[model samples]
Structure formats: structure tokens, C-alpha cells
Target: MVSETVSVSVPGNVDLAGDLEVPPSSRGVVLFAHGSGSSRHSPRNRAVAEALRRNGWGTLLMDLLTEDEERSDALSGQFRFDIELLGERTAIAVDWLAKHPSTSGLPVHVFGASTGAAAALVAAAERPDRVVSVVSRGGRPDLAGGAVGRVRVPVLLLVGGRDEHVLDLNRKAAEELPETHRVQVVPGASHLFEEPGALEQVAAAARDWFLQSAGSGPG
Candidate 1:
């Protein structure tokens, strides 16, 4: 596999840092949108990315916010909840992926965590033809507002069984989605899926969903 630290340019001359990994003859690529207050360096997301790479999928873990924006949000906690801005950035990342030489021909999938899931849904709605599938991990898909119903591709919502509130929200969001959507609960897991084998299960489910929906299997 070849892994590189890359920069993605968005509107307003802003560049977001990303870690991109592409394995030999990868069947597809998955872009990761991290939760609020998290970045491309998130351990859980990285673990999931590694698992996907092992399954012959490439991964791009990128920060939605620039360093300055992140610092400002740290002080004011404002930008993290700006779902519109986040969604736009996610869409920009998708555009970048479409132009990237290594990943352009492959199908695109998105894996979003927490609030990032909302942004991912909005991006999918905007680029219905480009995005093949989406997976949310303990996400606040309800926060996506009306955009949730606009997503045309298959969606998989993974939540922790013990996380009652998020589970309810996932159910409500799933209702707004099309019949291709599904909600899977991780037994004995919490919001972060920090329990033993919980994150692995999330990765496995995400991998299967992407492979099936995108028609990309092991290389």
C-alpha cells in the first residue's frame, strides 16, 4: 500500500490536511468524515480505515476544518455544528477525489462519525451520481435536517445498542431515508463504540455495505 500526507484544496483557498492510503489494485476508495472536535488523526477512524485497506479498499482521512478554523472552534465551539459548511467541505473533498488520478476510476464511499455523518449525508445528496454508498457510525443523522431524505444512495447507520438516545435518532433518520437505508445496532456498545470488538464490528459492517453497494470486492 502507498500512504501519503496530502492536501485538499477547497473553496476560499482553504486547504485541508488528509492522509490517503491506496493499496495495490484497490477496488474502491472510502473517504472519512470525522466527528466534531476530531480530525484526520482520529484513532477509531484510522483503525477502520486500516481494516478497509486490508479488504482492498483505499481510504482518505481528511480534516474538514482548517487549522485556524479548528482553533477558533476550540475557543467558541461554533464551526463544529455548522453542518452546511461541513457538508460543503465534504463535497469539495469528493470533488478532489474524483479528480485524483489514483482514485478517480474507482467507486466512492463515505464513512462518517458523529456530527460528520450529517455532513456526509448532505454531500451525498449534493453529489448523488458520484457517491455510491454512505455509512454512519454513532452519527447524528437527525441533525442533517431535510438533507437526510435527499440522499439517493444506499446508507448504513450503525449505532450502539446501549446508546438509547442515538439509537432513537438513527431510527427517526432512517425513516426519512429511502428503502435502501438500514440501521444496525452494535450490541453492548456505547456512543464511541470503545467496547471490545465494537469498532471492529462497525468496520466490518461498513466494509460489507460499501462492497455490496459499490460492486467492489476484494482485489
Candidate 2:
């Protein structure tokens, strides 16, 4: 396997910092969209990425915001909740991956956490010709608004059983999604999935989802 730090440029002069890992004979690549107030260095997301790499899948974990923007949002908490902006950034990253030589030609999937899941759904809607599948970990898919209904690709929504409100929201969002959607609740886990085996379950579920959905064709 090979791992490297990459810089991806999007529109509006924004440059995203990311960690890309490609395993030998990788079947596809999964782009990670972190939730509000998080970044590419999120430990939980990194763990999941490691699991995917072990499963022979490439992974890209990128920060959706620039340093200056993150600093500004740290005080006002404004951009963190801006799902449209986040979705646009995610779409740009998808395009970047499509054009990047090393990752191009590989089926693309998205793994989103929290609000990032909303952005992932929106990106899936926007790039139906690229994104093959999407998985949300403790995500707020309801925040995707009408974009949720437009996501034709298979989607897996993983929620913590202990997180009642979020689970309810996932259920509601599933109603608007295609029949290929699924909602899995990990028992004893909260929003963070900090329980002993909770995160492992999440990684396993995500790995299986991406593997199963790979080469199924575009969204």
C-alpha cells in the first residue's frame, strides 16, 4: 500500500488538504467527507480509512474547509452548518479525484459523517455519473433537504441505537431515499460510536458496503 498527503484545488481558490491511501490491487476509492467541526485528521474517520485499505480499497480523507475558513467558522460556527457550500466542496473534490491520475478510472464512493453525510448525498445527486455508493456514519441526512430524494445510488445510513433523535432523523430521511437504502443501528453506541466494538462494526459495515457496491456502475 502507498499513502501520501495531497492538495486538491477546487473552485474559488480553495485548496483542500487530504491523506490518500491506495492499496495493492485496490478495487475502488472512497472519499471521506467529515462532519461539522471536523477535519481530515479525525481519528475515527482515519480508523475507518485504515480498515478500508486493509480490505483492498483506496481511501481519501480531506478537509472540506480551508485553514482561514475553519478559523473564521471556529468563532461564528457559520460555515459548518452550510450544507450547500459543503456539498459544492465535496462535488469539487469528487471531480478532482476523477481527474487525478492515480485515482481516476476507479469506482468512487463516499463516506460521510454527521453533516458531511448531507453533503455526500448532495454530491451524489450532483455527480450521478461518478459516485457509485454512499455511506453515512452517525450522519444528519435530513439536512440534505431535497437532495436526499435525488440520490439514486445505494446508500447505507449507520446510526447509533443510543442516539434516538438522530436515528429518528435517519428513518425519516430513508423514506425519501430509494429502495436500495438501508439504516443500521449499532447497539450501545452514541453519536460518536465510542463503545468498545461500535467503531469496528461501523468500519466493517462500511467496508462491506463499498465492496458490494463497487463496479455496480455509476450513481
For each predicted model, how many residue pairs clash, with residues at least 3 apart or on different chains?
0, 0
**Candidate 2: segments with Cα more than 4 A from true spot:** none
Judge candidate 1 at residue 24 and give its lDDT: 93
Q: What is the lDDT for 207 in model 2?
A: 89
- State TM-scores per candidate: 0.96, 0.98
Q: Give Cα-based local distance difference scores for all models.
A: 0.92, 0.93
lDDT of 1 by residue, 1-219 (tens): 778899998889898999999999997899999989999999999999999999999999999999899999999999989999999999889888899988888788989999999999999999887888899999999988999988889999999999999999999999999748899999999999999999999999999999789762211
Per-residue C-alpha lDDT of model 2 across residues 1-219, encoded as one tens digit per residue? 668899988878778899988887789999999998999999999999888888889999999999898999999999998999999989988998898878898889999999999999999999999999999999999999999989989999999999999999999999999748899999999999988989899999998888778758895
Model 1 is weakest, by summed lDDT over 10 consecutive residues, at: 210-219
Q: Which stretches of candidate 1 lie over 4 Å from their true place?
A: 216-219
Model 2 TM-score (2 dp): 0.98
